[model samples]
Target: MQRVLMAAGISEDVVSQRPSNRQHRLVNKTLRRLEKLHEACADPRLGLKSSSPYLLELLPETASALRRVWEPYRGLGAFTGPAPGEDEAVFLGLHARTLLAQTDRALLLFKEAKEKMFDETSSYRKDLTKLSLLFSHMLWELKAIFPGDRYHGNTYNLTKTEARDFWKMTFGNKCLVRWSIFAEKLRCVHPFQEGLESVALKATLDLTCNDHVSVFEFDIFTRLFQPWGSLLRNWTQLAVTHPGYMAFLTYDQALSRLGRHPRKPGSYIFRLSCTRMGQWAIGHVTSEGDIVQTILENTPLYLALLQGHSQGRYLYPDGQDANPDLSALHRPDHKAKVKVTQEQYELYGKVGSSFRLCKICTQEEKDTRIEPCGHLVCRRCLDSWLQKSAGHTCPYCRCDVEDTEPVEVEPYQPKHKQEKESDTDDDHEDIELVVKQMASLRKKAPERKTAQQ
Candidate 1:
């Protein structure tokens, strides 16, 4: 109950929850010492050398205290282990105290605006921006306490082809990125650091095909939530629904107004799906739950829709242009289908006899063939080659074949009784040839030796 009140802006003196004696003393000492440290650090006259000498005397004791306080606060275990004793009480109490203090400061600024009759002469816009920044921070910190730990590919490195695929999925086609502003800054810490190591994760989204990139970043001290779609939706909802917020701040002109704004405060709901092949990393944020749920609900189907539409198959294509040529590319298909003569095929076929083994597939088979330019490829290797090698020409001879198709092969029979006729033919040929040759050479043959009994 005291913790709740404290969170609700009650004073520490008014907190009825009694903490353990040791913890109470520890909290008071730490807070007081921390205040002193801040004070000393801020003093302009104190040089680093002088300050360090003074601080060194207290370092060992301070370090011990800091370690004691930090044990629970450093990890997920911070959420558990006991009832509201002094350490927990002080720690939780500080969060509310800080927010309440900031809220009061914001309210003071807001009151000043009202007193000035909402006039342009007042520093109200500046004050409002400050208030927004503070409120954003407060909300940010509250959410950070138990951040979603799901990883998304955004936090890690990617292969070029994989990146291209991701880019195509994220931004290409008829779908454009919805304009956004008033982004929440969030962060995640790299756990292992050597001596004040601060490795921070940067978040960004690339809207490809559309050719755009957006970025969001925060200090590594705060743990971050991943897939931030829901968080983004919630944050956007809060910013947008705060009626006339942008207008009041004189920032409406600066923000992107891509479409109609929502009038009420609520979650921006959507269905998402992500690919199974996508990589994931640690310390990602999700607005409400695991990122897998967001991916399952939003990404897959959205990508499929984007892909389908990009392929020129829309629900209502009747009013659209009949030609499927991409206006942006400016290249027409008329040049792709020039006719070639049968004599060219015959000439190539004759020259193709010397070819063996595919150049690309590199299979050591004699089943290779060539085109008019004498480029060689085995029949089995053409399909994959055609799929990826766009603006097609034969890899080996650079032949401009009008049309190429996959070669079909018949099934082979097993070596059984079906081979009897082939064996008989071979025997008949060998017998006659050998007998005639032996007769011709009979006069020159050596006599066989008698066997010893």
Candidate 2:
């Protein structure tokens, strides 16, 4: 694992050197000091006024350690240096650190805000609001750094405009303030609602946070310190004299499998598949459905280029032209006329219609498909029969079916497009109404208090 890390371009010197017993003792002492400080802060009687002299002294030391760990590879230049081979590993390490730091900082701020909110001080509300703003800024920074829905593990990356629109949908137009107000009001109504609101708020704050901190920390550590150590270990192992000293380490990493092309589908090629003396053959399909093989290259290049040309033929490695047989290329025409039965013809006729209502459901419903027996059934009806029946056969045909997977269909769109969709407009209006209702309820609360007096 250490050798793998080094080969992947992580520095060996940093990871290979084990800490001395004295250093371990120092770490233990520091941990004990931190634990004492934590206990002092946890005392409820001291509240926010809890202070530890040791904490004040230890913070500077912690910061110094952090700087030592991160300062060398803090910027883009760390990965863009002269060594092209190590660029990818360096970039991965840098990105991992950035993500770690951002998540940790956000979590710390969240914890601090939660603590401050329990205080009876008048400034707590204002401080909480400021924390909310800071959270929003952090969210924005995260989005900017890792732009697009693809980064969020979506199907594809979004354009700059789409990203802006996504940001608007998530946190735009005082959404945080509105959610906070709603949550506060809901607290008076139900405990479940309050819990739900708190969960939602926390989820919104850390959108893509994962519980794999240890894995990332280990990877970062390995990447930072294994390269030089690996070299030293390799040299020492090789230096040990023996009668049959066979060097086990071999350079076999150059071989790569560039996976199959989408057009060619299943056929794959490897980098080491090409031979220096092999001949390249080009197969062309003739008008009469015959393939003609011709020698494209006799003295071929050692490296294989798996990319396809404009004519849709992939450049592949071929064997030597030994005993060339043109008779193998002759293909007999086996085209047969497909005769549709009366029932199948009727089913085809039904499918050709503009609309076919599901016979099993209401007349207004159009979710219908023609079965093998030329009968139309709704998906729901078909699903019910498939579930309840032991045979799992088609409802109309009663044919012994092996599988009941639904056929893929193009998405249905209405012929007449709407001038303006009401759903989004209605949603916006509903939000406005809710905000107004909340404002009125707040006003009435004060009036009700006055009346009771």
Candidate 3:
């Protein structure tokens, strides 16, 4: 049995040995410190506090202390050593590192913004408020990234694609656009830093597709520089030489050309281009410390330059007028609303009536409808179904449904009774009172008769 357990990767000796008291104490101390830091960072009052300078100083010190507490347990082996607390210690260390990095990045941005603020800027307070909000947003992102022990190890080394998807899903498109602009600012401000451009470009492209070289295969070049160059090159070369690559490139080029056509006005391509232009404008204004003039004057010129750079010819041939009847193109269609058929209404009613009783328990009280599908289901029946099968579909129609708020239906009551019940309630109470009094008197009489006998 011991040999079998050893073969299964569990050593009895290692399992039997306990972590040292000193290691346990250290782990506990580190956890307490982390908990306190997390609570402080999560506190809403941190943002609302009047002393910004104090917070700026205190946060870094707290981050440094957290780093110091977790330094010794950074990569302690859990299985090989008698350190039972190693796993927890490592997880806490990674979480601390993530939080510390985020705090440092936010602080850098805050300090930069503060330096940019001048006496001429009347909206300094507003700018400071925006910076504070941005810092809070960064903290919120840290919470999401390091949700718990499960993600602590993996979040730090996420692939570019995974990071992009995570950002888009968590922060949304607007925030993603802002992040792109912010990354560009970071790249420009620290141009001398190694690999900053590549990192920024990768991040931007992950969020928004690159239009200029969207057709080319750049993965081959990236893989060629890696340690396993020969093997990767052979693999990537085969992919690049595949017949489908040419077909895909041709399709991509055709689509790109179509998108640039002036008359066609590709809405998606236009929106992407506009987003890029907006990012550029934001970076320019923020860095230059002249927001209004740059927006009013330079933005239009930049847009005009983009128009001039387009491959599509806006001019028509010979005697054709430029201002053709564009009104016809812009005309809005007034479509009438479609009404549901009587048959469909009757079907819905039948479905609703079937749920008057609980399907699982056969009780009469349950009457709730599933959302979007409008299929009726008893709450108890649904709960039982979820527990047994965990299925997310309407039982009657087998249509996919989400676990949303159930719409409850009141049990049918007679209209005449409902109206009269309110009036008769007081009378009913009085009659009940009289009956109770009579019953009490009868009981007393019986007792008195027994006493006389």
Model 2 CA RMSD to the hidden true structure, in angstroms: 30.5
User: On residues 223-276, what C-alpha lDDT tens digit does candidate 1 reach at each position?
Assistant: 011112222222223222322112211122111121122221111122111121
Task: Give the alpha carbon lDDT tens digit for every residue of 1-453 in model 2.
Answer: 354334333454322223323323333444344344344434464243211112233334343343343333333423222221232223223333433444344345435656554453435433422332322332332333324411221222222122223334542321111234333433442232346446643332222232111111211111211111131121122112111111111112111111112232222121111111012323322334333333322111111122232233323222111212212111112111112233322432433422233434434332322222223345577666667988656554566432221121222233424432322211011223334545777788899999999
List the global CA lDDT of all models. 0.29, 0.30, 0.32
Question: Could you tell me every candidate's TM-score relative to the true structure?
Answer: 0.21, 0.18, 0.22
Tell me the deviation in Å of residue 135 in model 2.
1.5
Question: What's the TM for model 1?
Answer: 0.21
For candidate 3, give the lDDT.
Answer: 0.32
**Count of steric clashes across candidates, in order:** 13, 8, 0
Task: State the lDDT at 156 in candidate 1.
Answer: 25
With candidate 3 superimposed using the best TM-score fit, by how many Å does residue 295's alpha carbon deviate from the native?
Answer: 34
Across 137-215, the per-residue lDDT of candidate 3 in tens digits comes to 3233333333441223222322122222333344232211223343444344223234754553443333212111110
> What local lDDT does model 1 show for residue 79?
30
Clashes of 1: 13
The runs of at least 3 residues in candidate 1 whose Cα sits more than 4 Å from the true structure, single-residue gaps closed, are 1-87, 111-123, 129-453
